[model samples]
Target: MALLTVKNLKKNYDGSPVIRGIDFSINKGTCVALLGPNGAGKTTTLRMLSGLIRSNGGSISFEGLDYQTDIRYHIGYLPQHPVFHSWMSGKEFLVYVARLANLDKKTAASRADELLARVGIADAKNKRIGKYSGGMKQRLGIAQAMIHQPKLLMLDEPVSALDPIGRREVLTLMEELKQETTLLFSTHILNDAEEVSDELLMMHNGEIVESGPMEKVREKHRVDKINVVLQEGFIPDEDLITALPSVIRTEVARGVHHIFVTDTKQARDELLQLIQAERWPLERFEVGRASLEDLFMKVVDS
Candidate 1:
């Protein structure tokens, strides 16, 4: 059963439609990522889902309750720009939030400490928010969001401010959290969504154009990719590649040509055979699995 359902959700800003009747659901104990380019309604959907903004039209139900009323308690939202109290220590800020959520003082302290440890910010528990780095702040944001153990977590651009190492840390943390909690976050970065998401909601032109389990979606919209680095420099004729049955085509850059094959196995064999026939010096070749980025590009571009 779905923990959250969004059906025919629509919204507008300044008389311009921003989210155009998108539909999807979030299952229990899964990560559903909202992916898109800028101005693709991802942020708008996130805001509406979290109750920060009312949708012009839609039904949002969570945990057997209407989202407008009974389900807020079960959802945690971390906005892109989280404004923590600068003067308050990380622990103190979390306790403050817990208190506002009606946690008793004793329970609040325990929750704060537990979450701080869970997000790996225990060492900085006493440090003020002003002193924390971008990654540290993101982790703290996640800690506070999960402190109450909400079943649904919504994080917007959670790793946008982090360096590569920090981004990996956040993704790892999200993966760990997925063992028990359902997460739906919005991000423009394809790799971030690809790394940690089980399902993807691909938004385009201010609407959710595609959505499904990530791997299933890729398979359904499969396009094979091949990258080759020829010894020295070799350029395969475009017509030769296009002549291959159902193969999309070929592209070359910096002495490396990439083939987009419609059939994965056929592309592999055909390319190898062609290489052998041409007696071309081969340096390196790679056949890649279908990727979320490919699916995403296909959807948004179409």
Candidate 2:
């Protein structure tokens, strides 16, 4: 079942529309990625859903509760650049957040301890926030977001600010968190989204241009292309390859030839036959599946 539903969601800034009547839903126990380039209004949409900003039009329903209701109670939001109280210890910060969530003092302390361990930062719980590394701070931020046991967790560009090690650490934590909550994280990093999400909402120009299961979306937008690589000092005749009946066009970049084709099977056969007849020096030939980057470029350009 859908844990959250958004219909005709719209947002405007000073007479300009930012979110233009976008619609989507999040199913329970699924990790959905909101993907787009920078300036795609990803942050704006998340803020609206988190109740940090009001939509100019449309409705947001969480578990059937209307937008007029205080749905923030059911949402845990971590902004891209989350501010931490550097003076406070990790455990102290969580306890303070938990208390704000209305947990009793004893429960707040207990919950803080539990979450610190859950996020794999129990050893650093007593350490000052200023002393924690980027990854540790992100983990702590996630823990704070979950303090109230929210049904939906929204992370805005969660790993965008981290180093390689920090990014991996937070990503691993996200993978684990998926088992426990319905996660909706926004990011422009296609690989990260592909790594952790089951569903995708591809936004562009403040609108959701495409959304569905990751595989399904890719299949629907699949491009017909073959990648060919030749050994050093060997180059295939581009005109010869493009003249094939099944081939449409060819492009070469960094010693790799990208052959766009009409039919993969026919193109493979024709290219192989030609290569054999002419004794062309071919190192590798691959039938390429459309990658997320490919799909993103196609959709955004369209």
Estimate, for each residue in 260-287, the C-alpha lDDT of model 2 and write its tens digit. 9998888999988988887988888888
Q: TM-score for all predictions?
A: 0.87, 0.90
Candidate lDDT scores, in order, read 0.85, 0.92
> For residues 145-250, what per-residue lDDT tens digits would candidate 1 score against the true structure?
8877888999999988789999999999999988889999889999888889999888998777888998888777765688878877465566776787857878
Candidate 1 displacement at residue 48 in angstroms: 1.2
lDDT of model 1, residue 171: 91
What lDDT does candidate 1 reach at residue 130?
97
256: Cα error in model 2, Å:
1.5
Cand. 1 Cα-lDDT: 0.85
